[model samples]
Target: MDMTLLSRLSDFEWRIEAHGKMRVPAILYASEELIRDMDNKVYEQIVNVATLPGIQKAAYAMPDAHWGYGFPIGGVAAFDPQEGGVVSAGGVGFDISCGVRTLLTALKVADVTTVQQPLADALYRHIPAGVGSTGRLNLDDQQLDEMLLNGAQWALKLGYGREADLDRTEERGCMAGARPEAVSEFAKKRQHREMGTLGSGNHYLEVQHVVQIYDEASARAFGLAPDDIVVSIHCGSRGLGHQIGTDFLREMVLQAPQYGIELPDRELACAPIESPLGETYLGAMRAAINCALANRQIITHLVRQAFAEVIPEADLSVLYDVSHNTCKVEEHMVDGHLKRVFIHRKGATRAFGPGHPAIPEALRAIGQPVLIGGTMGTASYILVGTDESERRSFSSSCHGAGRQMSRHQATKRWRGRQLIDELAGRGIIIRSPSSRGVAEEAPGAYKDVTSVVEAAEKAGLSRRVARLEPLICIKG
Candidate 1:
């Protein structure tokens, strides 16, 4: 793919003009080099997204954009129901609400250095991870329904975590309007024993140190300080979310024609929002999102337990927890009027600007923190949404150091033990059940997140707040 074919709209933005059946233009935000490295499939898929029914303004791709099932991994689009808005399972993704949450701890980097190995071992023991891993919870049909219906609140009631923890989470830890009846028996069965497990493939738990603080005031507001140790948990709805996405995608494909919706790609199959098919998918998707929230909430408790065991005096408080996938109904100003729109954000984080009522009160002054998890052995960043981000990209920002190589490609060239030793030489600690996992997540397999963040900031998506490097990581 000749990336130079992408005409620039600005220093950090490019556009693919509406062509053929496209109803809107495609917008991509990334550095010149990043664009060159992107797969031609990404560009082709973004073009397909532009054809989605009732899509508003434009279809936006984050700096992390990469080819995925249908829409690119880092894709966003808003649709208006009054104009035949449609919902696509591809947009919501395989793992609904797969996201990141980081907690600030009183312990410093020096404190962890003393017993890093012990702490890593303790965290690994406490947090269940690996392929097909399950946790302590075993739910029957009735209890699974309750968990799906109530989400994180149900987990809290089960003594997973406290209510105050909800305050620091997006949507207060439970997605409203969730209807478990929309979920299938297969979905419930998949989630029965997977509640607290961090299932494999890119999901992880890392203990890191704040290496730099860019916005002092914002950092203070977020309860972060230089060199302070932090724990980051990243996972999603597990098998349940996947089952929901798959079931709905099949239904949407068969029903799109009934709603008079055309698909440029079968993977982008969708049904009109008013259609029974759309409502069914949305309801079930929201329930899966709630499942993810509960899953993360339970993991939060495990993390708390690990910290209490290793550093009893440390106070671990959540800075923020935000999902990077899922679709939601939101009101945003379009054409000078408030409009209800369905916003699809897959592998992208919501970075609502300052003064937005959606942001937590304490964080409204500094804007929402955009948590960008980096490669397993690399650095992660904390950024604050900008007014430009809200205005230009539907309050969306980059999700991570997007994959630069396919998992197969990564594994073929790199081995697990070598990666472990290499990271340890750089003072990064690691523990994982699968050596193949390490090979698949080699740092060399991802784009330079630092470059991506720079483009995002320059493009006014999100401004940097702080950067963190891993001291310990548990991969699932």
Candidate 2:
């Protein structure tokens, strides 16, 4: 992170002009402090991404950029298929469709304070969490295929959620063009018993209450008010998504040479978008996306049951569900022409602006809700997409307060039990199967979320709407 390595375009924008084998420039959106704190590897990886074939515009990293496989975790890049575009598994990360969904409840902060412990216990009991956790539903091979193809709609058909929930979800509950057949048998087996379970590592279901509202109009559009209770679930495709990334990355690397792809880094292994391998990977990846959508829907059902057990009067409804991983086809204005390109967002969330057809009809005028997750002990924020973001970074925004330290380093610094007790004293209930998991996700392990969001807003990535603080957290 040498300051001289990049040209400062503005207070929140830095640029690396095209050099060496780079096909386009590399842009990073962050404040001067955030840029100075970023690992040098982020600069290396993002520059490498610019060398990929058919890449459109420039390779961009969000304010929360951090070192990661191939592309930086907060990387964003678009590629054109007609111009020999390539798809990289590493750019999408192992956790495909890893996202967050916030559920609004009828109760207020006062209502939850009375039975917070019971509610936490009920959620921990009802929702399976931690590594290798399995859920109540065990899908057979046939059922698994059906679930992969149908996504959350399949869960609704099975009485897991309501029809209205799909309206607030990305892809309207099911992703199109999911070829379940492309998913390997082993991958299917790994997911068979994982549906509805929250896998370990930075995943959780938290009960939060709004503490502040930044944009009154947007907050009202999102049905938010002071002290309103909301449950936010953060998880993803579990083993199935990891298996897909593993299966495809290996193939992509081995076949890169055959396709005349000279990868600057093996982790950036990719194939021509028109290649058979590319098509197969897309099929499998889309299926994993569906798997994640279905998984969240089922978890929502479990959360509802947990709430009913603790507070029967509570009514939970989907506010918004958005994924931060995977590659997607989107239309963008490049060089004054509207063109279709495949946009890869690793640890970045899509913040489609208002008036986009893809947004839910009711919320379209306001814009997509961009949910930014914070550590269990910190505060999360709700932001709305801005039209400026579409032009600035392809409608991409920071996913979270990017990790500044590794899990191992976090454990060394703090004991999980002690951290839990400390968080508990702050009126935040912590429930987890493993104390070590809690330690690994210590609030100190991540960059200041407030700073990250502020940088994103300054960069015109999104507009903050509301801030939420944790009341109860069920960690994986």
Candidate 3:
């Protein structure tokens, strides 16, 4: 992160040139100020990622880059299977398919403000949250398998959500290639009661109002307007995802030597793309992605129930849903030839530009919606993918205001009770199961989201569409 050590390519691009076993250079997109604030570990992890087999173009760190397990949290890299590429467990992260989904409500800020506290209470009562929270749905083994395979489509079939919601979701709400048989029984048991639950640790459900529109066209496409109310759900695959990551990461470490893959760090353990273990991990990982999609769908239903109790005529419709942590098989141009590659985005969102077939047809002309979540009580933003992004970083962008400190460090710095009271004074309502959980996610513990989004736009990764200011937050 130090200026003296980096090779500056431009105001928004910095490079760590290939050296030693590195197959490609490490490129980071961020402003000088953000770069200086970043942990030195991010530089080391990205450089380590570059050393992996069959890495393409470069190992990239987005504007919100931070130190993570193996690759930096905001890292992006693509690997070609035909070129001996490998799949890394650390790259996809533990909370598989952890993402943000915003829903458009017919109500406005004025309608919510009048009944804010009671509405917040209703939401907290209806939506299960916090560590080890269990939802109303208790799945049997058969139902669990079905949900794992069907995802949001399963939820819709079960009357949790409408048919139209699937069209606005990534991969149409169910990632292909999910192998329920590959998922361990232990992982399945862990998630049997987690559906519709919001697990703890930075995960939340917030009610927000559209405060600004930067791109008129995209804003209209996303159904945004000044004072319009929206509910955003930020969560993931919960226990199943964690168990899958834990199981495979341990297995990959043991299998790495057999595959002749040298890991710079044990945490970066991986298997060759063609290997059986790699295929198995991918199967399990995709299932977890489906689990998350289904989980969010169920929660969306619960959110509707809560809103109906507070405001009888409220209509909550899906805007878009996207995942951040994933390793997706996609095609990209390399050396003027199209190449099929596995793109691993850790704490990074897929920013498919306009006309990308993966995006929903209704919004194809504008591009994929890239939701950037801010810390508690801060403003979040909705940005659109751009064609320039496809060329620059394999169509990836930052996920959020990357953590500035660890949860332990944050808890030591601020008391939850005081933080809650402070936000309450600012007209923000905070509802949570534990005051301690609140302390660990204090707003000061993250980088400035506005600055991060600005750097992302300046680097041409995504174009801003609108800004959202939080009215109430229900923390897990």
| Model 3 C-alpha lDDT versus the unseen true structure | 0.94
Q: Worst ten-residue run, lDDT, model 1? A: 1-10
Q: lDDT of each structure? A: 0.90, 0.95, 0.94
TM-scores, each model vs. reference: 0.98, 0.99, 0.99
Residue-level lDDT of model 2, residues 109-146, one tens digit each, is 88999999999999999999998778998899999999
Q: Runs in model 1 with CA error above 4 Å?
A: none
Off by over 4 Å in 2: none
Compared with the true structure, what per-residue lDDT tens digits does model 1 show for residues 1-75?
467667898888998889888899999998888888889988998888999889998899899899987899999
Residue pairs with backbone overlap in model 3 = none
Worst 10 residues of 2 by lDDT: 130-139
| TM-score for candidate 3 | 0.99
Question: Model 3, 301-356: lDDT tens per residue?
Answer: 99999999999889999999999999999999877888999999999999999999
Q: TM-score-based ranking, best first? A: 2, 3, 1
Strongest candidate by lDDT? 2
